[model samples]
Target: MLMIKSWIYCCLLTLPPILGLSQNLKQEVEKRIKAEEMPAIALEILATHLSQASKIRYYKETDIGHQSFECKFILDRLWYSVEFDENGAIEDVEIKMDFEQIPQAALDKIRYSLSAYDRYRIRRTQRQYTLAFLSSDDLLTMVIKGADELELRYEIVLSVKKDGSWTTYEMLFDQSGLLIEKKEVVDRQTDNILYQ
Candidate 1:
């Protein structure tokens, strides 16, 4: 019994952190809000493209000790998600896109990378724009002009089979399908009231 107890203790100690739990909070609520409630910087950047946008919705993400804002809208029939830091600086802009939209070379690379897994299913894909130190005016111009000059990256979510188990992971890849970051999707927290 002692040996069994020792094994259980080891297993519990080495367990990985919960997949979906952010480092900042046990739970996070992404609540939608009015555009007017957002900071001036974020609004100004958004205003440049408002002429062609539809169904614009703003959301504020508040974790225990972190805050960020996001605006999602449809532009020219394409879905766009723009995230801003607390200071209203553009963090990243994501455009929902089809998997086939990836360039041939990048698609090939992504397939090769996925080959390591036993099996995988692509869930979603997005084209992400991240410009470094770009002025609001430049961003406004670039966004309004369809982002043709920007180097966009692909963000993909997939359910992958590894070691005979299925796990969901969010992966970021450059235009060339080079791996940038991989994070496992965590499950949502259970309600304590139900258990109690």
Candidate 2:
């Protein structure tokens, strides 16, 4: 009985340290996620939403502070993407269409449209750029024109997916906080876009 009691005591003494180690690991993981600004809860939400889909893929974390999830309904030949915030809110939704792929011709069209405004003269004041989602595919570029006359130019790329979804991959903002140029490159083979 004495030996058994001693063994039980030893076991009890080891249990707290083991539990502490587990808790420490959990805390470390939580810290890393927060430091990285990853939206784990958001991924969970997206996973639930796409649970019924036939195929689903996830991309790397976005620089814009959101996580992206791609879903494909093979039976319906449909594909879409959903972006979520750190807290798991549905930040954006994209619907894939057949013409989602942007051919070289469409690139020329975008260039033409943006080229029409050569001399952008905005006030020489400070402004802020805000991210706005026009639709699942369309990210509206917004900025406040400054007080003085400001002249600037830039190029931006908009990624168009097969389901007619478009997004701004990357953008450049001038001093007045106006977007001068933007470039959106779509990976047709992977249905992913690198917004640089």
Candidate 3:
């Protein structure tokens, strides 16, 4: 009887987080922060590449259960963002892109992938770079220099009209326009996947 009681107690103790997991899965929050608030390593990495960068902004972002820091700026008239994990390890870099930026074949594939929706209105498009098989420095270099490499992927935000209702979604497509992940936005009005 005591053993059964202890097992029940253990399950009850862990039940809260499991129950909260569903509520937490799609939650994301963004807050503007000062440069000094960024991790030292992230700041050092940014300083190396932000020589002529302008309009730089620092943001602390929380997604699901993970926290990250991002530095966004305009470099050569293009918006760029560098994200670092809570531990100060570089995560990825993103650059704003346009429909025309996607390769012709890839765009066709991307369109085909979205054909199921009645219509998908694009809200935002960006090229994401991560240190997949390369070092962070190398990945950052690829991002700044516009070098299309292995770690490149496209992150797109779209509003889809399906079943006569509009729903916002954030989609990630690989460099070849293959669908990676599609996450539905909880609330579009105040949601911030990437800064506007």
TM-score of each: 0.77, 0.31, 0.81
The residue-level lDDT of candidate 2 at 185 comes to 38
Q: What C-alpha lDDT, on a 0 to 100 scale, does residue 8 get in candidate 1?
A: 97
- What is candidate 3's lDDT per residue for 1-196, written digit by digit as tens? 9999999999998998978644646677899999899998788778878889999999999986699999999998999988899867779988898977798988999999999999999999998888888776667777788775466789999999999999989999998899999999765454465665
Q: What TM-score does candidate 1 get on C-alpha atoms?
A: 0.77
- If the candidates were sorted by their TM-score against the true structure, best first, what order would they fall in? 3, 1, 2
Highest TM-score model number: 3
**lDDT against true structure, model 3:** 0.86
Residue by residue across 1-84, what tens digits does model 2's lDDT show? Answer: 999999999999898897764333211011112313435655444443444566555443434333433222322354444444
lDDT for model 2 comes to 0.39
> What is the lDDT of every predicted structure here?
0.84, 0.39, 0.86
Cα deviation of 61 in candidate 1 (Å)?
A: 2.1
Q: What is the C-alpha RMSD of each candidate to the true structure, in Å?
A: 6.5, 17.9, 7.1
* Candidate 2 wrongly placed segments (more than 4 Å): 1-44, 64-75, 99-181, 184-196
Checking candidate 1 for backbone clashes, the offending pairs are 19-186, 20-186
Candidate number with greatest lDDT: 3
